[model samples]
Each structure stands twice: as structure tokens, then as C-alpha cells.
Target chain A: MLLVLAVGPSGPSSRSEGVLVRDNNRSHNVRVTDQVQSSKVPVTVLTGFLGSGKTTLLNRILNEEHGMRIAVIENEFGEIGIDDALVIDAQEEIFEMNNGCICCTVRGDLIRILGNLMSRRDRFDRIVIETTGLADPAPVAQTFFVDERVRDELDLDAIVTLVDARHIVWHLDDERPEEVENEAIEQLAFADRIVLNKTDLVSADELEHVVQRIRSINALAEILPATYADVDLVEILDVGAFDLGRVLETDPMFLEDLDHQHDQSVTSVGLEIAGEVDEGRLNRWMSWLLANQGVDIFRMKGILAMEGVSDRVVFQGVHMLLDVETDRPWGAGEERINRLVFIGRNLDREALREQFSSCLVEAV
Target chain B: MSGLHVARIACRAEPLAELGDRIASVAWASDGSALAAGSLSGQVVISDPTDGAVIELAAHELGALTVAWSPDRRLASGGQDGIVRIVDRTGEALAEHKGSGWCESLAWAPGGGGCLGAAVGAQVILWHDGGQLETHDAPSTVASVAWSVDGRRLGAAAYGGILWFERGRAAPVSAFEWKGSLLALSVSPSGKLVAVGTQEGSVRVHRLWTGDDLEMSGYTGRITELAWNSSGDVLSVGDADSVTSWTFRGRGPAGSRPDVLGGHGGRVLSLACAPSGRGAERIITGCADGRLRLYSGTDRSAPLAEIDVGAAVASLAWSPTGDSVAFGDAEGRLWLAEVAP
Candidate 1:
């Protein structure tokens, strides 16, 4: 049973002025604004525990006609047998394969694969990746933010997780739940939309309980119920989850609070960028962080206002794989500011903030 | 001094066939008659250096991560599947060496000897012809490996720094620690100096016997590759976006800061210095922007010639006679260009 839950606005906006106006949902409006006129290809990450239905959903998406060309990066646990099995349809743009999980071992493979996909820029309209069950989504997501080649060609849309409803309670209660729960919960914890599958066996009360539990873990993610892995195609793709405009309009405190409670074993800190950042100073600070606190820092990202560059330089890292790139120019009437977030375990936010702040070049 | 003298030389050549994959490792045959390239698709292709004709050797079950060519031109390649394979002259797998970790880099010892070295995960393995393999503890995850000119020592660059192990020794003779991770290392042809390139874009030169160090700075990206000239006076360093040459002043009393030779557009991935006694020797470089270029020692500000490879040039090597150059690209395409002086 394959399931896909894509959620976003239907059809192109009729607004001729190029800006969609909305009062109640500023977050959604912001996303639409950033996406306007920008043919940013949506990036969807398919994540699940081993055999939790990730590849099943991936196959379904490949077979369907979404009116856009899609590229699928199937990250297998070992050898990449999925690429040979994929029967290509002329309607789809391109289908690529990245065998092995997206971790330290295969990070270089990810960069090369993404670079190759971008070389044929006109062949695909969007990209979809099915991560190995044990793979961490943060590094994969950070790829889009870090590599200049990837950033120039692709825009991350959303991180989608397929939850095994039947095994959820049991998996979470294991003695060393951190092992299974870390990847699973991190998947859901960072999800823009989660597909809670295999729910037909559970009672309505039990399903509600599971939903509540997911909410307790991640308040930002939208939860959708799945029976035998059936989900709407329109509900899971192009969710505009990573739309920067939407990210800015939403209560900044959303990520701040979620960063704190997402994992008792992990924490995230957000820093404000008020001035130009010296590249040398930032390098020293990052070196110190990676050298001293790398074990605790699982992930870090920042939209920096550099000293010379007019656009915001975005940087992200997962463990040792750090990537930095220049993003879209600050639009007319947009404020030039910097914001960085660090996600990890037992990090001293004040110390990090102080170090990062000291890296700022003061106005002479 | 003000403009940082540089020039862009464009090559008029067609692009290599698209392998639809990323290139992982490349090597040039000792005779310079052929080039071998490997990609993430688990395909190895040997090609004619001039016309780019390919002979595919589909041996590995998984992606090949590194390749080395013996002095006699026998090919030894390591793959992500933890297998080291020796390919015959016909590019057929003749022997297999198995290990527990991913084999990342390979280096053939100088001379047509039976020994070959590989940086496999966190350890260095030396494989001899009699089926005996010796292992030495690498300081960190080994990213690159090189053999001393005499084959009596092996140098490996890893996470924290560079480690040199003398043959038959259980521990490293010396270890040099640095701030950032070491990305690549090259031992001088004369066996006098070891050049180490780090992730912070700094190139450090060490006097092999004395452990003295000289660090070069100013690059904003990671140093990707390094090569030492046969005379041991000049060093070629490639980084994420450019390539430069460094010349040492003297052996000891008059030792001075190394002079910089610069020319390259993208991050240089591979470099090779022409053999000694070749007047005004040329340094060949491969870059991310898909170019294979040559620069003369006399005029470091400009490239003598630039050939467009149409894929990221992953590795470069100079022929023994210095009459031709060999390079491999990301798509596992190899090219040999006949140089006219």
C-alpha cells in the first residue's frame, strides 16, 4: 500500500499584481509570495523507519501524473537496486538513483548526484528523495541550503514522514527508545506534514491518542490519517513548507519553542543577525564550535548578512558536512537581517550566541 | 601584486559522453598511454588519452571510490563494497582483496614493485604480491594516501593532520597535527619534503626528516589536492576554486617564504608536475569547472593551454616523457592530449 499526502494551494494564483493578499493566514501568504514568479522546484523528502512504507510512497509519486516533471533519488540501505527496477514513463522528467543512506559515508555521493541533476536543469520540474530508513533528514535538507550549485537549482519544499501507526507506541516504549525514536521522531519532528499510516486497525480513540502524542512531539507538523497507506496526491507534495516568506511571517517563536521541546536529548538556538559578519571571525567561531561542541551539535543553519555580499548567505551543517550559499537577493522594501538556528543536544545557547555575536563586524 | 596576475584560457573541445553519474576516482597509467576513471555507478572506463575512446570495465558491485595504476600499468581499484581489485592489462579483474571498511584512496609504490597502498577507512593497508596485507593505524579517517619515492615510507592525511609510517613499523615515525582536517598529501619526488593540504584552504610544507613546518594562507576554500615537482623545489596546490604553485627558497640556512604561482578559475581537483631536468617544467591541473590546463613555471600568471573536458576534471597526471598529459573527469571519461613544445 503506497500513500502520498501533498498539501498546498491548487492552481496558479490569479492575482495579476504578483502578490497574493490574505489577512488571516499570513504564513501561507508569505510562502506564496516567495514562490511567486520564482520557478523554484519543490523538493520533497520521503522518510520512514526501515520498511515503514517510504519507498512504497515514492513509487506511487513516480507513477502518478502531477502535471510536472519529477526526479526521484532512491536512497537504499545497501546497493541501489531500485534504479534498475524503476520503469520510466515519458511523461515524467527524469529519474535518478542515490544508493546508500545519506549520512557521512555517502555525503559526497549526495553532492555529486545533486550536481548532476542540476546540470540538466530543464529535464525536471521538481525533485523527490526517499531516504534510507536509518538516514537522518537534517543533512539531506541541509544539502539544499548549503551547496551553491544545489541552491541555485533547487528549493526545498517540505520534509514528509510516514509513521507506522501500529508500531509507534511499542517503538517509543523500548528501553533504548532513543535509537529507533531518534530517527523516527526526528523525521516527524521536522515534518511539514506527516502521514500516519496503518490506522485501520486502531480504534478512533486510539488514533486520536496517537495524533495527540504526535502533537506533543511536534506542534508545527500537520498530521493526516492513512488507512492501508491511502493518501491524496494533492495533500503531500509542494506543501510550501520551506517557503522563506511563510517562515518569516509565522511567529518566530514557533521554531524557537519547538526547538526547545522537540527532543529532551536535543536543543536548538536561534540568533539574530544585526550587522555584517566577518568571514574570518565566523570561521574561527565555527571551528571552535565544531572542535569543542561538535558532538552535541547535530545540526546548525543561518541566513547571514555578510560583510560585502548584498544577498543573504545561507549556511547549514549536519555534524561535519557544512554547506554555505548565497540565497535570493533581499527584495525591495525587505529588511536585511540575519538569523541563525542551531539544533543539537545540551548546547549553551548563550555561549553560542555570544561567540556568534562577536563575529559580527561593528559599524565603523 | 595588486591584481593577482591571472588569465583564463579556453579550450576548443567537445564534452565527454554523459555517464549520468558522479565521478569518484581517476588514475593515469604509468606509461601515459591510457587513463582510468570510476564513478558512483560502479563503472570503470579506460580510455585513449587523445580521442577519448572508452573501454568499459564493469567489475565492482558497488561504486568505485579510488584507483591506482602500478608502475607496470596494472590497475588496482577500491570500492564502497569493501573490495580491492587488481585489473589486468585488458582491464579485467584478476584478483580481489577484501576488507571490512570502505576503501577510499589508493597509491602505487614507486618502481614496478609488487606493493600497493590504500587508505581504507581509518587504517592504511599495504598489499604485497604474496597475498600478505599489512595494516597500520591511521590517526583519523584517511582521506588521501601517498608513497615515498623510495617506497620505504607511506604518508596518509586524515582528520586532524598527517601521519608518516616507515615500512615494517607498527606505529607512525612522526605525526603532524594541525587546526583543520587534512584533505590531501603529496611526498616530494626527491623525498625531502611532504606537502599537506587542509580543509581550511591552507597548504603546509614540512621538511620530512626535521619535522619543520611552513604554512601558506589566503585561500578562502578547502585545499583539494597537492603535487610536488620532481626537483622538490616547487609544489602545486589545488583548492576549491583555484590552483597555485609554491617555490621554496633554500634547503636550510637561507630558507624563506615560498613564492606563489597562480592561475585557475574553479576549484582545482588534481595536479601533476612535470619530471625534473625538463626546463621550465609545466604543472597540469584539473578543475571543477571542467578544464584540464597547463601552466609553465616561468609564467605562472597564465595557463599555456586549457582543454575543456566538459565534466569536472577529477585527476591529472603527466607522462614520464612529458610529451603528453592524462586526465579523468566526473563522468568517468579519460583524455590524453599530446603537448607540442
Candidate 2:
């Protein structure tokens, strides 16, 4: 496997403890691209259910000195509240850093903030992103891969999950646990390291049972027990982990590898394209998708090398709504490609991929 | 139906004289033959429809903000000085009614002889021939007022919501509350539907009798005005970005969203739909970007004709005979353009 090396800033000065495993060494044979130059900037995605100690953990992180210049991106569910007076240097809404980390509001505010962060590359050492309790990680993850500037300037690190151990069993047994579990499990599923916070409140057997549950969902992930999410900073950072690489390595059993499938409630499918598509065809396809598949598909995004266009066209749809915009051109020596990832339940992946591929402009 | 015939009328944009710096409000008569243009200088210009010749009438003190004409062709003009002046065809002030607050919106009852309604502060006042002004307390600051066809009820759209009142009732006949502040309201010709445009970019349509509401959402900006066609089947709503039309199909359920009619550039301040039997009656819209557009509800892909008015248009009205259209702008200039079917 050829590893594409990304040329940019030099790697961080600190040494990484983990051994770099070659692509062929893994059973999945995933091509691990060394294209991104790591700055050792740990972008910790603090995620949990609503009112699940995410902000509390954030407040603690801000108070303690970890030596690294941490830029926190706080994504509040409603209107943002005033932060404490101690963090006076923080930007009210979205701010960047001179050390390499960038912070911003969540969801819609992500794109603009990331775009701004990429413009000033030398500013941040690491980024810590916090998401609203209800946000799906797919869109945020896709952002790092979809934009060339983002992929070059920043490297996606570990996803840290904060679990309420006291309410875990009860939360899992509720009628709509699928709602809470979907976000929780997805965050955990993609995490390189899991911090089962608030463990002091749960019984010893219950804590062990929860750990087993987490392992059942993701066997590859390292589970770390913590009373208040207080773990050594070195464990969370410099993990040298990439889930996308793991996903590609799984090959034949890509989606079927996990023992627990995405909640019988929600599922996702990746649609690949071999050729450029017409603008009109895309519009018709989107209208048809909105009319027929809108109710079923909660989120959908497509990055296509559109016909007659030099730059890739990125389309994002929330429920029945769709917005399309042009992104940066394909990088030097990079292939002009078309790839769409759809996350929803009961979706006919084969049929959708076929329909999406048929929309491609036919060669004369 | 017959290949969608679209006709264009061209008018040379000429700056109006005598409208110097004191201009206020402008409107057109029902027949579209003449215009009732008022100014802050207490001057009114009654211009000919075919050629821009004026019949100037010096009517009041202080600037006029709104103008309306009764079905019988009596011109009613309201000013910021809290005075309502009723003028005849020759531009002579016939009746003058004095009020306490600024009179912003003026409308005549459809079939009633000479009855008129004006929104002054938080009260909606109905003025009759005997010089009596019937005042009704509005839920909030009254923004605009419109009278139903029968003249039996007057609908007032306030900063809060909708207030419907009958002639003799001390209390409101009925009221409807919406999520955002109300900007304008329009009642259907048959008195069946009342449409209210809100600042939150939504148009809420309520059946006059049942109090049922159907909301149509699409605009990301504020809705400025609303108008109903003569037949009352179609409705045209004006928002900050565009003007949309909706077909009220006999009112079924609550909270129904209507089909959107999209295409317009600036804030659409006013809209007027032609009466029935005019052969695909078009919707005329006045925009803040100073463009008067005519749109065919059948094919909303493009505008039939766009007239550059050179200033933000404040109001638009269609002729009773459907042969012409009248438009007013922020500069107190009124234009009457001949329409060919």
C-alpha cells in the first residue's frame, strides 16, 4: 500500500509513544495515509446526553493548566451563556489560537470557524471541540475529510466520551434509549479512548457490566475508568488513531464488523461515484430524495467532482432541506473524485448508490 | 391557458415635479384613470392615468402617510398629523375627521357607501358619513387596518396579532395570536379568509368564520404585506425577499402549509392581485429595491414585466376594470400604467 505523505508544517516536537503500525500489518489492510502532518494537537470531542457533565468537564479543563495552548470550541444547544470571568481572553463566540487549537460554536457555525482557522495555520497547538448533546458526529467528521484545507492544516485526533455511570443502566432501559444511545454509542464507537466518568456513583458490578457493554460496542477502543474524567493528559492525546483508516481496512466486512449494529433505529450507508454528475441531474435527484427519502434519512452529505467544475461541490441536507456550495479545488496530485455518505435507517444502500451513480453525466 | 400570453408596458422613468422634499403618500383611484398622490407639504397630485399630468390639491398640514379610495370613487387620505381627509373626484376635501394618534393605514369598506377604517396608535377607528369615529381598542400597537367586503366587520393587524371587530360590538368579535409581530393584513373579497403577514417571515391564513389557521413558511425574512384576489381563491403574500402566492382550497385542517411561489430580489413591500375573469389575473408586487413586478401565478418561473420605479414602492392596487395598475412609492409619487389583456 502506498502511503500518501501530506507536506505542510513539521510534526510536533514531543515524541509519540505508540508504535506506527504499517497498513499491511492490520488484518483490514486499510491504507493509512501519512498525508496529514501531526502537530500533536489533541482535538477532544466532549460528548454525552443533555445535562451529562460535558460543560462541567469543559469548565474543569479550562481551570487546570495542561501546558498545551488549548483552544476550546463550545457548542451550546440554545443561546450561549456567559463564561466565568477567569477565561477573559476567550472569544465570546468563535475564536482561534496562535498555538494550533481553534474553538467555535457548534453545527452551522462550524464551517465558517474552520474556514477561518485554516487561514491562520500557525496559531493553534491543539483543538478541543465540544458538541451539542444531540449532534451526530458524522457531519463534523466528514468536514475534516471533505475540505482539503482542513485536512492539510489539522489532524483529527481522539473522540472523548463522558458517560453518566449512575444513569447508564436506567438510560439504556428507557423506551427511547435509542435516541440517547445512538449519540452515546456513535461517540464511543469512534473513540480511540473512552473515559467512563462518574463511576463512583455506580456499584462495582454495574461498573464492570457497563465496561463490558462498552467493549461489546467497540472491541478495538481502550476503556479508561475515571471517577470524574480525571485522567493523565498523555493517555488522551498522541493516541495516533484514525477511525477512517480503520473503516477502510475492514474492507469486506466494513460495516458488519461491530457486534452491535447502529441502533436498529438508525443506519448509515456510503455512496461512491465513478464519474462527474450534472447540476440539473443533482437537483432532480435531491428533489426526489426530499420527496421520497426525506422522512427516513435524517442527514445526508455529498462531495462531488461535478461536471465542468474545477472545485468539488459539497451538498448537505438536513431532513428534507438541502444546501449546496463549492469547496476548495482538488489538491496538487490529488484525484478528482465523487463520494457521498448517507446516514439514515432502513436505507436501501445498493438502490441509492445505483440511483446516485445513474445521475452521472454520460460520456459522449 | 392559451400558451400564457405575457404583455409588457413600458413607461419612461421621469422624476415627479412639485414633490420636492415634502412628499408623503400616494395612491390611485379604483378606475385607474387618476392618482391620489399626497405629500408632507400638504399637497396632493391627482394625475391622469394615460399621460402624467397632475391635478394638485393642497389638502392638510403635516405629511400624509396613507391613502385609500372608496368603491364609489371618494378619495380618503390620512396624515401623520392625526387628520383623515375625504376628497371628491375633483381633488376637493369633502369631509375631515380629527384623531389623537398618527393614522398610518386607511381602507374603505368594500360595499358600504362611504365608511372608512384607519389604524391610529393602538385603536382602530371606523369613520362614517355623520362625522362619528367608532374607536376599538386593539390588542397591541395597530400597524395596519382593512375592512371586510360587507362593511359589517373591520380587521386590524397589530404589533401583537389579529383583531376582528363588528360594527356594534364593544369587544373584538374574534382575535388570533401568531408567533411574531404582525405587519399587514388583507381580507378576502368574499369575507371568507383573512391573511396576516408577520415580521417572522410567515403568513398565517385564518378562515374568517371558523378561526382556523393555515401557516405558510419559506421566507427567511419579514413578511411586509398580503393581498387576496377578487375571487378570494388565490392569495399573494409579500415578504422581505420575495412575493409568494397561495391557493386557499376551502380550508380543511389547522396549521396547513401552502405551496410556495418564489422569485423576487428585494423586500416585497406591497402586493395586489387582479380581479377574476381578467384572463389569468396577474399579481403585481412593489419591492423596496424600487421594482414593480407582474407575476403569473400559473408559471412562477419568471416575472411577466418589471417596471423600474426608481424608489422604494410603498403600495400597489389594481383597477376595478382590470385594464390598468396603480403603484405608489416612498417619494410620494403615484404611477398609473395601462394594462393590455
Candidate 3:
């Protein structure tokens, strides 16, 4: 099978030895394109700056009759008991704790709490982790991938970041403090869905300016303008944001190899090819790319046109955790083009595009 | 011959809540006199089997993950409150150390070492005499902790692998990179090897001398419990509906296969191997279908006795003497079974 994926977690040095394998005896080839690892429950991470309406969003998710059982894990700075009356009436299992931060320091607590929940699996169907506005989303997301127990039973669905429309620009432009870690940039950089929360709090012009600023920082994320964090539950739940299927569905120019546009250190590279790839040669090239540049390539995803497969290959990675699976077959009259996208720091676009282009099968 | 009895403890079951009495862990005192059960609501119930004398102490506000009796017969436990407390005969706290995260597992060093090891979050705290606690960082969240039978090293199982800490050292002397969360740990009687059960349904054996690893897989569910026979010649592990034992003889568990002990229809929640101190090689398994069965090594297909309590069995432990077994259930009930030959 031809693999199309990005090595994520860190910039281009770490290797993802992780595998998502399903070996069953099936004769008919009816396949689902999403390949979101159906057996495990999905966890959506809600992160934003302080006062970004994360709690308001959580309260809404708690009160709504979404027909899904959600366990809310909240890490806060002080002892704000999450509106006990409201929580009790909603009949949600709310676990709140005061920790250093959800980023790296208090991930252990999150894992422990998650482990406890996994044991009593009959109670809840999904999980929503609300990070401290000051917390980083990387470590929190990494926990779901690194914990062997959690990875087996849970999937990292998406990081839904709610940005305060009125006051996010100051955070965007202000020099990052060395101690607190410029969480603002990461909140934007790592988000799968950026909710311009409280859009009414800002004027139309101001909203446009903030949106533009966010776009410059993260060119790929889908930005949704929302009032009071009110977005359809369908948009966020089970988006498989970590899987890259939605991005591929929406962006046809997924392989354009656009110029880098984010942090001075962070960049993006996209490539598209029309020829079929030899699976063996493609694997060798990918192994080399991930070995030499895995840590730098934070997120890589691609749909491949391969020599001996009617199905579109879906491949994704986060640092050293790579996943590849056969998606829905090429539709009737659809073009068999290969597309690849990589988001990371200090990407060598020219060299990578050239290296990937070499994997195409040579004409007879 | 054996007889079993259930304590008529009035724990009002309110669906998932058990009147603050859902038993999380249970253990018999090292001296084999009293059995202690820790509950999610932070209550510790110690009962004397000789008579029906029982003492219940509200030790923690939330829940306790583990309870253990030191070689000196003092009961110590760790709880969801992140507090480790040592209690005396009068149910008074002798000492308490507050860690940051949930205090999940506790193990006492064997060979009368008088050292207690605990895994609280990502750090393993070792408590020696005089209320001194030594903290060592774990690679990830520690699921279980065990001490070598000789008390030379302590092992903490987490996501990346098993970390081995030398006695009295702050750093892990070595690590076994198994790439999963290790849910259960068992050290052989000779301290020559350790067996760990992973959430990915594999039991891995690590030789203490060479760091060589052996993996035994093909289980239907995650391996939740592991126990070794007295001589440590065989290791027993549990899955969804079966208990399997693998030989640890010549080259460890490399070429060794497992003998299956069929179980109830649902998941096997807990497993206990009778202490070989009394010439018994029997394994007890509690299943999600509320069935508890004891299987002798000789008779693999038939269980010695099957009991039904109508609640999922949460945890089980064999008395050090191998004469009795104590088990706790999801609804906070405790049962004691005494066997005689």
C-alpha cells in the first residue's frame, strides 16, 4: 500500500513508529473513507485564551440534548467548582481540578482521570477536555497519542480553539513572555477549528482584521465566526480533525506547495502529482523523509494515486505517530491525482517536493 | 473442602454510587489475620475473619486506589485524593504525605525490607522509616508499581515502558520500552524476572539480569491482572473470559505457551493466585457477569466452586497463607472464602 502521511508532534527529526492496523478476513471491499478508528471513543479538546468563552461553550454542550454522553474534564487555575447546581441538573459527569497547567505539568492528572473513566466505560460515550486559557494544547493532545491505554480506547478528535474576537489581536502581536510560553500562537497554530467567539463583541471591521491576523498565523484551519460559542455540535463532534480527511475533502488545491506564512520558524509545504506512485519506492522515500525530517514536519497528510489500488490511500501523522489506511475507492469519472500537505517549522519545500516527485513511477 | 461467606454490609446501591462504598482495592494483612477493603468513597473496612469484628474508617474524602499492610502489620493506603496515609491498629493516621495527583498504586518491598513504594501520577514516591519520602520521576503516568522479591529494585509501569529504580536511588537504573500502558505487574518469587500486563492485551516478561523481553499475546481483551506461582515457575494472566498461565522455566517465557482456564461470558475483572506458601496452586477469577470461580492448576477445565453475587467483581486477593481469599464487587460488597484440605 502506498502511504501518504505527515510526521507530527515535533519538527523534522522524530520518527513515528506507531501503527493503526486492522487485519480481518473480509472478502467484499466496502470501505469507509474517514477511517477514524471506529472502535475507540473520540476526545475533542477545547482551548483558547482566558475569557474566550470556553466555559460558556462547555455549559452549552452540557445542557443541550445532543443525545451523546460527554464527560467534561476541566483544568482551572482556582477553585471554581463549575456551577454545581447547573452541572448537577444537567446530569453530566464533570471532573474539575486545579493544576499547574494542562500543557505538560498536569498532563499526568488528565491521563489518570481518563484512565479511571476508561475502566467504567459504560458511563460515557465521548470526552471533552477544556484546557486552562493559559494552557498549551500540544501536550494535552500528545497524551492521547502517547498513553498506550488511552490510544487503544480513545481517539484525539480535534482541537477546537475559541478566540475572543474583541481582544485577540493584542495577544497576537504582543511579544511572547518567556516564562508563560506564548500560548496565543500555539492556540492558533494547533487548532483544527478556530471559533471567532463573541463575534458580536467586536465590530465587523474589527472581526475582519482579527480573522485576517489569524489566517496569517494558521493558513489551514477552518475559521468559524460564532456568537457566544454557538456552533452546531455536528461541526465539532467526530470531525476527525487529527485524521486530515475533512481538510482533504474541502481543499482541492491541497498539493499547491504554498509559500510559508506563519511564525518565522513555522512554515507549510504542499505538493501535487498526476502520475501513479510505486508503493515500494514511495515507502522508501517516506521512511527517509520521516527519519531525517520527522520532528520538523509536525502534521503531514496526503491522498495517493498508486499503481495497484482502486481505493484512495489516507495517511496522516503527528510527530512519530503515523497512520495509513485505504479510504473510499476512486469515484467514477474522478481524477486520480495525488495530493500532500505538510505543516511544520523550517520546511525545505524545494527539496521535499523534488524528493516526493521522484517516487512517481517512470513511464515505459 | 472450603466454605465462603459474604458480609451483610448495608451499602445502598444507587446505580453507580454505592452509598460511598464502591470497593476499589482489597488486600489481606501480611500477617494473614485481617482483610482490608478500600472504597472509592475513601472508606477502609478491616474485618477479622476469626469473629465478625469489623472497623470502618473514613480515611479519605474521595476514593482509595490501593491498600497494603507493611511487614509490621500496619495498614497503609493511597487514594484519589493524592494522599498516602499510614494507619495504626486504632485506625489513627501515623503519617500522611500529600502528592499532587491521584495516588494510584502502592507496594511494599519484600524480604522484610520495610520500604513502601507508591506511584502517584508521573512520580514514584518511596517511603522509608521515620516518615521520609523519596520521589523519583516516572517516564509517564505510572499504572502499577512492584518491588523485586529481594527488595533490590522497584519497577513502575507506565505508557512508554517499565522503569526500574535501584533501592534508595532517585533515578531509574534501567527501563524496558514496551510502548503501552502497563496495567498490572508481578515479580517472580526469586526476583529474577517480572511480568507485566498491558492494556493492549499482552503479558510481557522482563528478565532482571539481561533486560531480555518476552511477549505473550493473543488474548481477547486487555490483560488486567498478573500473578506468579509460589516458586515463580509459572505466570498467570487474565483477559476478557479466560485466565492463562505461561511457564517461566528454562529460557523464561520465550518459547513457552499458555494453558487456558476458561472463564465467565464477560470480562474477567480480577485474578488472584493462591500463595504457594501452603502447597496450593489455584487461581481465582472474578468476571463482569458477577461470577467468581477458582481453578486448580491440575484441573484446567473445571472450577473448584462457582459463586454468584449479582454484581461485577472489582478486585480480589489471596491471603498470604493461601487458606482464604477475599474479593470486592462493584456494589461495595466483600466476600471471604476459606478453604481446607
Report, to 2 decimal places, the DockQ of model 3.
Answer: 0.13
Top candidate when judged by TM-score against the true structure: 3
Show what share of the native A-B interface contacts model 3 retains: 0.00
Per model, how much of the real contact set is kept? 0.00, 0.00, 0.00
DockQ-based ranking: 3, 1, 2
Least well predicted 10-residue stretch by lDDT in candidate 2 chain A? A96-105
Q: Per-residue lDDT of B1-341 in model 1, one digit per residue for the tens?
A: 01122232322244333333556666678776777776655677776656657677754554677777888888888876668888876777777877655677888888866788888766888888666788887655677888878887788887657887765677888787664457678888778788786644466777777877877654544466777777777776665555656666454212333334455666677778876565437778888787777777677666677766677777666666776665657665545565543
Tell how far residue A269 is off in model 1, in angstroms.
12
- Candidate 2 scores an iRMS of 23.3
Distance from true location, Cα of A167 in model 2, Å:
56
TM-score of chain B of 1: 0.85
Could you tell which candidate, 2 or 3, scores higher by TM-score?
3
In angstroms, how far off is A143's CA in candidate 2?
35
RMSD of each: 11.9, 18.3, 8.8
Q: What interface RMSD does each of the candidate structures achieve?
A: 21.9, 23.3, 14.9
The weakest ten consecutive residues by lDDT in model 2 chain B span B1-10
Error of 2 at B126 (Å): 1.5
